[model samples]
Target: MQFLDTINFSVPLLANATETVDSSMVIKSVLLSLVVIYFVSKLGGELSNKVGLPPVLGELLGGVVIGISILHLLVFPEGSTDSSSSLIMNFLQTTAGLTPEATPQVFAAQSEVISVLAELGVIILLFEIGLESNLKELMAVGIQASVVAVVGVVVPFGAGTIGLMTLFGISAVPAIFAGAALTATSIGITSKVLSEIGKLNSKEGQIILGAAVIDDILGIIVLAVVASLAKDGEVDINKVIYLIVSATGFLLGAIVLGNIFNQTFVAIADKLKTRGGLVIPAFIFAFIMAYLAAVIQLEAILGAFAAGLVLEETDKRKELQRQVIPIADMLVPIFFVTVGAKTDLGVLNPTIPSNREGLIMATFLIAVAIIGKVVTGLTVFGQPGINRLAIGIGMIPRGEVGLVFAGVGAASGALSKPLGAAIVMMVILTTFLAPPLLRFVFPDETTTATLEAASGTSLVIESDVITLTDSQENELKS
Candidate 1:
């Protein structure tokens, strides 16, 4: 009995020992990775600005430079990575005296922590975008935006799916999965670029923003249908209908209820007496809203966005916007940089025989990706002189949303290696190229200038230009 008791005690001791190492290594590794993220993001952003490109593009390239395709400094454990492929892992082994036996555990923990931070970064980004967006303008373009979103989804999905089946002799299931991938518009990336170029509130910008939001709803529905088919060989009509109803109700209900919430939100903020009087309550609301959305099977960012739209109606909106900017500046780059890092550009290499076919397939997908989205701009019947071309180009980038489709499809074993690679290639090209093209097509205006331009038709230019009113003149003389 005494010997048996000793054996149990030893096992607990060993387990505790292992846990301690894991906790220590995870902290060390995440800190180092954040240092790399901050340095590269700022450097890349400055250089990008110097060359007149969108800073987001530069931050993305900076991520690629440090990721698996190049320095391997910021590698993740997913895909085909080994201990040897990760610089941080090797550095720990060398300097921190990390035992080879403990490397895998430490590496996984480190990657998981960093990934969570990156996700939080994006959530904050969407929340900030929601604050900046004009809810009234977004609703005014509702019909046109819905039309553009449907066309954006239908055109690419139909073309890509059909083209793969007929041109490449691919099966219907895999083709459908790829088609689903094409349906997503990375609203995060699109909105970021629009904000960068002072186009976020223009008629075209609001339309694109509204359309992108709708596109996300459609993409989620399409994903559920295809994923079901991939598993069980048929669609789930009930589940599909549930998603459609839930999503529509969520949006409409939230906007309608926003008026009531806006007052309560202001009241709560006014009562708070401490340092974070405003921002703290604001974040709590955003995070809770994000959690609620995730609970209802919608994207958490959508919830965060809804939270912003609600809060924007409050009188404190301008002050809240000013407060949110620094927080955004701090966290948002991690999202973009991590997106760039996760992308493996090696699949595009032509010398490898396996990649040769993928490259060819990628070329076809890329053309379809561009043409399919570009045509959505022309679908607007009522909005004349709305910069149809800019709206189309704005919808071009697949960004991280496409990656989710690729990841899910690959995990379901429905995507062949070449087809997966081809999908990834199309996503990479579209994500990188869209920002500059959008900036080129939209006129450069200050935020004030853009607002003025947007309202130019409505402005009444009276003949009393540069003339003071009688009340103003009397006040000035006194």
Candidate 2:
């Protein structure tokens, strides 16, 4: 009598091994993701519209609700794996035979896929954002914005570091990591809120947007420094400086190279028998730039962002944005959902209050997070009728930027598990909290219009005006 090895021949294996087999586990993951995405996105949009908040805020809240630690407990009894789990192994195990020990390998494979998808999502997002952004407008306000951004980043970072060191009794590295976490301005949330409130083109909005961009650059530098300090006991001040300097240099070089290449590429595309071939080259250029940025220890999204900025000046800019949007729309939501899925609300459970230092730490970090950005509002000089408070609040949400920092910190071992957990909680809270607060504080078009009128700044409108055809205007209004 021959007996099959049940462990080696599970349902999951066959499902993963053949796409035609229709593995239940893969189907489960996909269906669950779709259901989660549809309901969460719909609920988020509906709630935000009802509350006069940005739909992104709703989506984020949806993410929080659908997260494994929250709604997933009732929906999926088996906990969701990290973004890095292996579907093949999962399938093999279900279809063929696999032991619990083999599951980790599956997880490792899945993580790679998640990372790639997340990366592509972010790149597309940044590119689209850049396409919509007015560089000239950003440049005109850059100096004042830079001042506000620098002060905002510095004060909170200092205060948080001090609090962590003195009040929390944490060591230098952990404190620094905490401070680093406090540095990012969640641009996505801020932009969405500003757009929803019709303040996106106001002087205050311009300053906030420019400042947020500067904040991102500064935050990445701080992250590099903190990561270094976490690795070695002492901070490598020189290395940190070098990274910043190098990143700036790279930015300049890329801008120049991109401009030259874009002109040449456009000329070639104009002559091409099939204009569609231009997209292939454009994507290739984007990938190369992204790769180069990664090689220099900078985030690839920055490169993608730069590429988009450069491409915007060319005739094909609209085409590129149009082409990328569909792909971006589909994949970007996955990134957001994955981010929300990572929330382990179990960490916040107070059942064992004595063992909840991480939650306490997270609360403290949230306080620091709020205080730090609020202070930036005070730093806006010479702009009368500017709600510095509003601007600061606008900068408060951590969103994707915070995630990037948390991801780097966790991967580098600079963040202890407790600290990392705390940071993530702080991120989720700030992301969820900022939109509602902004809506309450800066409510209505009248307030934004009043502020814009008082500032005598037409800079905002002139800057954000994307060329609109009659058809496009009709579409937008609809």
Candidate 3:
């Protein structure tokens, strides 16, 4: 109240007292929400690290605590359609540029702004992922990665769809959505784990990373088809075909043209002596590609990924990576936290009669999700000496993509509350499961730092060097 008074008295406003109060209240609400999110996210991340869990998991748990489903600390109402809640709901709806007629639709719009910001966060995150990827490395592992990715998609989709229909007696349409949820591998989670273990350059790690990128593209295509089926009674084969062709063409074309653009950009920046030259242009290209991907009925992250690949081939790759990381760090948590916030645990409780069926279905999906990916380990038989189990385990987490599929299904009415909750649980569990398994199977390689004091030699810790030949090991022992 004191703060409100100071603001009102200080700013010479033309508006009435009530208008000022309302506006101030709205500002306070938004500021308070952001404060809670940042503080809780950091706390969650720190606690998660202490327990040997990924910070991402902690950040997500933090969101769940402060979100509507748990503490009810967030002011965004879901289903209350009466009195003060209704008034606040109406105000939110009006702010969203709606008629404010007060309906169930108004309830969903309450979090619209937050949802948009969360989406932006994910877009930026993907851009950073793309920037880190090397096109040459991706191509080198293309054949093996493509095979792994294709099989990964087929197995999980089949498992989820077939398992749901058989065990839970779910109908066809909803089963498809459940299957879609299991398809995409979260590159962010996989990459973080590999980097932590210092195996990112390992052959197994390379294949996993390459395969994950491929899976993302494939997953988006699957999402498009399922979404199309939901909207239309029959499948539009032409649209599906177009998505594949267009996405392929866009990425390829971007890479080829982006190389030329990169050279020209560097040349121009050198000649003109311009301030903040290439950075702005590079960002513009990423955002434009992101926008174009959305325009063409694919996920924006795809375009962002392509943008990163384009930039990866440029001379400014290192500088671009440096510039993008800070932005990604700031925004990525918003995406993860919002995803966590959206998850409703109540609907997945087995004790609830209404939720029992969903719980059973969720259990089935989780089993399929695990087994399907685990079996993918054997698919890398062509490459001997590589730990196939590590690759498979790395591919398990669904992360942002699964949440996206579940959200789409729920919004489209193809999935009920219980079923959506089930998918969320499956995603969370898979994310939680993969890291420890990877660590156990492919333990961190001994870094040069570990050998420094004893050897006193500046030997680089290459993956190949870590695995010494028999003679080398014998000599070391001697």
Candidate 4:
């Protein structure tokens, strides 16, 4: 028998060995990834605090520094072939071993394990986001938030599309992809900013938080629409409508179901008097709801958000939050770092920039990115003493949401390399710009605290303004 035939015939033997080898490698990869994420997050958190910056910025910078491309270059000199051998072999061996005829099944097994772990990272990130959310506060400002979110999404999308079409001479598909990229508002960084400045519960902060929730919902809808359009050469209005309806229904249903379940689960936990007994059930419910949302063409994060909202009415909510947060705190940074790692700076090295037409297109898209959300700040109606400027600055950061759009666009081939590069740059700039501008606009504790008081909100000061430590902020729920 041929060697290939022999290998294929020995599949059962290989499978058993592969499982053992894979289990070990997976453990090693997860441990290594965790260690890297821990040290990077710690260092980033320290640098951000030292410089009066959001810790997320530090985390992202660390990710970029240690990204595959950058690290590859550093570990292997420019003209060296030594590093290529293992890298190529790893990729090929992993791909080949997935089939029946292969010597090393360990590579494929490691890949599967890493993929599962990465997915877990996503789930935990969403859960943390949900836990941090305050549904009552969000509801209070829902109308204003809706208006701001709409304007923020629509204006940038329109501007981005038109700019791309008119100047870059791109088609509607790619233009729409660019527009979709502009719709997300990264609230994690904004939340950190508000916490750092002790204004997380103020009227402006409430508006920002509310608007950001809506922003994420709308952003996902836009992405779904753009993706559908790219595939069929026409927008699937029916799919879009179904997505909206399903998302709305899923959120409402999860809220009602979660409230009912949370009460029952908490009662059981109380009867048992066991620590964290309720968490497993809560997590299971969240995963189930998230799965249902995915089935209906909605993002799982939306369902996770609903799950958090539903748990708000439970008696054991604080205990639940406390128990789950530490796990989330450790795992959430992996999601952010993975996002930064996907960014390829090499896309910026383009030969067409000197083309006047390309330059004009890029300029227009940049303007759209800047102006769209800035205008949304005016949507805070019926409120005086509101710093619309700060609200706009808070809305500026595009962090994870933009990255999601860019990733989808790249996968669908709707975003060209140069355009993707520009979008990434735009996201990074907006994120970095918010904190300093916010500090400038709302300078002191007196002003921020007074604003909070006027809004009938409470402010918790956990640390020095100019010097923040790595401690978590005291949540100021209304």
The model with the greatest TM-score is 1
Q: How far off is model 3, as Cα RMSD?
A: 8.8
Q: Give lDDT tens digits, candidate 2, residues 174-284.
A: 788878888988665576567656666567777888788678778878876787777776678887787788788877886687668778878876777775666766777
Worst 10 residues of 2 by lDDT: 1-10
lDDT of 3 by residue, 1-478 (tens): 0001111133212245253324443343444556667787789888987876667777778887876567654434333323234344444455544343433333333344455556677777767766666777767877888888998999999988987888778889998989988997887677766755666667887788878877887887898789888878677899789979987887778768766776776676466556556566777888899889878766676677778777777666766667777777777777667656655666656788977766777788888888888777788856778798888898998876777787678768998776887898888778768767777887545455334335586655645235444455556677
From the highest TM-score down, the ranking of the candidates is: 1, 3, 4, 2
As for candidate 4, its clashing pairs are none
- Clash tally, candidates in order: 0, 23, 0, 0
lDDT of 3 at 191: 75
Residue 257's C-alpha lDDT in candidate 2? 73
Among residues 3 or more apart in sequence or in different chains, the pairs in candidate 1 whose N, CA or C atoms overlap within 3 Å are: none
Candidates 1 and 4 compared by TM-score, better number: 1
lDDT of each: 0.84, 0.67, 0.70, 0.64
Q: Pick the candidate with the highest lDDT.
A: 1
Candidate 1 per-residue lDDT, tens place, 201-243, comes to: 7899999999998999899899899989998999999999998
Residue 364's lDDT within candidate 3 is: 82
**Segments of candidate 3 deviating more than 4 angstroms:** 1-27, 74-110, 192-201, 268-275, 416-418, 439-442, 449-478
| Residue-level lDDT for 59 in candidate 2 | 71
Clashing pairs in 3: none
Against the true structure, what is each candidate's TM-score?
A: 0.90, 0.76, 0.79, 0.77
